[model samples]
Target: MKRYLLAGLMAVATSAIAAPPQPLASADVKALVAPPAKGIKVLALWSLDCAYCEENLTALRAYQRQHPDVELIYVATDPAYQRDALEARLKRAGVDDVTSRAYADATPDRLNFMIDPSWGGETPRTLVIHADGSRKAVSGALTPARVADLL
Candidate 1:
């Protein structure tokens, strides 16, 4: 019983050390969309309340594992106040290692517009940005094949 308790404590401590999602403002969003120095950058937008977001996150985690060189950025569409919930979901998905951010602006609509003028404010939205700053945006849950094709 003591050994089990010690192991459980250690696990909890390890998880606590994992970085939590940062707050994302409109300026941050603009910076995120910029092209990377090398390799492709994947921006995945999700929400704790969206059922499809979980599935998409799982697929993204698997894809990241397969292609370690790809840059994966996860942005939780939930308000900044729900940071705890967003972090919990990211932990559950085993994706806390990736760069994570939560929408922080009071006027999220404006932020959404900045992200993409045509986007319908949907969860599970994905943007595959190339090194040249060009990108393809997809709105919906992504499958393994879809992830592969995007990369």
Candidate 2:
């Protein structure tokens, strides 16, 4: 019976693995904010170990729930190889369903510069991309005002 129970637990654990994120290359960063953006987009950058990243992701998820029109995009700063942990965190934050991507480039700085020149390799960086292609970047935990800024 103990062996059967252990096997069952292992199966459950394997089944609980979260969906892996898509790869985000530096070259594709501009496409997120370029023309034909269609709708308001919230691009959230985070990592597995970021202190405030989960809070920010939860806040963004809540904001997205309130305003369904806003597109939510999650970009994990961790490499694609760490997709398991990244996706697990996103699942816990309840934003896993939104478009998700992980950094595929070897040079993290290049990806950061492509996303936003002003970004200084900070975690929990959030960018509000307007339909008109203008972008507003905020670093740190997201607040009500920051969520409103997406509009």
Best by TM-score: 1
Residue 99 Cα positional deviation in candidate 1, in Å, after optimal superposition: 1.1
C-alpha positional error of residue 127 in candidate 1 after TM-score superposition, expressed in Å: 0.6
Q: Candidate 1 on 68-125: residue-level lDDT in tens? A: 8788888888897888888888888877877888889998888777877778889889
How would you encode candidate 2's per-residue C-alpha lDDT over 41-99 as one tens digit per residue?
88889988899989888888888888887888888889988888887787777667677
Q: Given candidate 1, what's the lDDT at residue 127? A: 83
lDDT of each: 0.85, 0.82
Worst 10 residues of 2 by lDDT: 11-20
Please list all clashing residue pairs in model 2, or write none if there are none: none
Can you give the lDDT of residue 145 in candidate 1? 96
- List the candidate 2 regions with Cα displacement exceeding 4 Å: 1-18
**What TM-score does prediction 2 earn?**
0.81
